[model samples]
Target: MTQLPSAAPTIATEPGQTEPAFRLVAVAIEARILSGDIQPGDTLPSETNLAETLGVNRSTVREAIRALEQNGFVRRETGRKKLFAAVPQSRDISRRLKTAMVLDHVTFEELWEAMFALEPAAARSAAQRRTDDDLAALDANLAQMRLALHDSDVLTDLDIAFHHLVALATGNRAIQAARLPISELFYPPFLAVISRLNAAERLLFAHEKIVEAIRDQDSRQAQDWMEKHIQDFQRGYELANLDMGTPAALPRAGHDKQ
Candidate 1:
């Protein structure tokens, strides 16, 4: 008579607890990647190979690959059967954090407070370290802003980009990641308020001052102007009678690009 197969090995956990096979497989593959055994651009082993090497079913390995792909740990080229390794970008992670913040019901007050601490710090850093390229980018933004000041939608996009360029000038990865999402939500409502109150000129003037301070390597001046600029946002919002208690959101429809 044929003998029954041996039972699978077990790990320590609470009674009646069993990790899903796919999850175990995913963890195994993730460990390989993190250990640098699988560098980005290295193609993953075929499902058949993984199943055989890991002593799991092909279906389990397939599911694990799917999970890894979803988490940005694995990427497949178009029209290709092989999956390549990939390091998840800070931007990809920031988008998820932004969604989580919105779901957590974060408000304009919370975002503004965070900006109050972060933007001034970023401006000071940018002032000390900004390059010719950084100044050029800011100048370009201001040029666009000059024409878009009366158009809230165009102004909104440029405003968001202006602050981002400032953050990039600092060359700090941590600060960049910290502000990316908050900045996404920060400007839209405030720009709408600015437009309603016709304070675009004031906003543009502040931006010009801050950029000049950065160009001059004047950290104190940059910090002061950034602080004033952020304060102006709050002031304009109040003047427009918009509620600060409102959730931070994307600004409404902007001018037609045509």
Candidate 2:
């Protein structure tokens, strides 16, 4: 097992210069996780040990761990006493950020712009690198989406899964990691738009075309088709009477409870 760089000391400086003790610790721990020094499911050092090692107060260590847990870097096992480091799923990051966006009222236009920038690049990569397994996964998700036309919950899950499959097909872990949260944030509002437009068939048709392009390893076609497909959803949202200037709302607790 490789060791990560030691955590840096937390220092007080002028405002905007650096984060306080807790944030610094959190960043150091996150770096270890990203670098694979702290593998998923590994136990972190006890709070007292970490505090002593980092020359910080135990309260700072506690705050850092709380932040990490909130971000899905660490989770408490059910009925278990210890906290453990974990690999974060894209859903985890998206959920937190999307929640913040909802509270801050981030506009649909902002999200659409971000997607337009990211998805086509993902499509191009997937076309070049997708394997048979990746194609099969996409096919499976498409099938689920087809069956889920009337089932909003299923449709929503498959929608996210479809993009996740694309990211996986790209064979770039960094892209996959970066893409997940954005894709996750994109889907619920998209599902809302789809439901409103009665446009399930059209959406499925576009998905099929995109999948075929990836299956055929046509990078340019995949990129172009994906961009169009994503843009089409934005159009659907507008056509469905959604205010593009209004931020997409977060799902309330007990909403879409799946």
What's the CA RMSD for each of the models?
6.5, 5.1
Please give the range of 10 consecutive residues that has the lowest summed lDDT in model 1.
1-10
Q: Candidates' TM-scores? A: 0.87, 0.70
Q: Pick the candidate with the highest lDDT.
A: 1
Compare the candidates by TM-score and give the number of the best one.
1
Per-residue C-alpha lDDT of model 1 across residues 40-117, encoded as one tens digit per residue: 778777777776666777887789889888788888889767878777778878777777777677899899989998
Candidate 2: which stretches are off by over 4 Å? 1-91, 150-153, 253-258
Worst 10 residues of 2 by lDDT: 4-13
Evaluate all candidate structures by whole-model CA lDDT and list the values in order: 0.81, 0.78
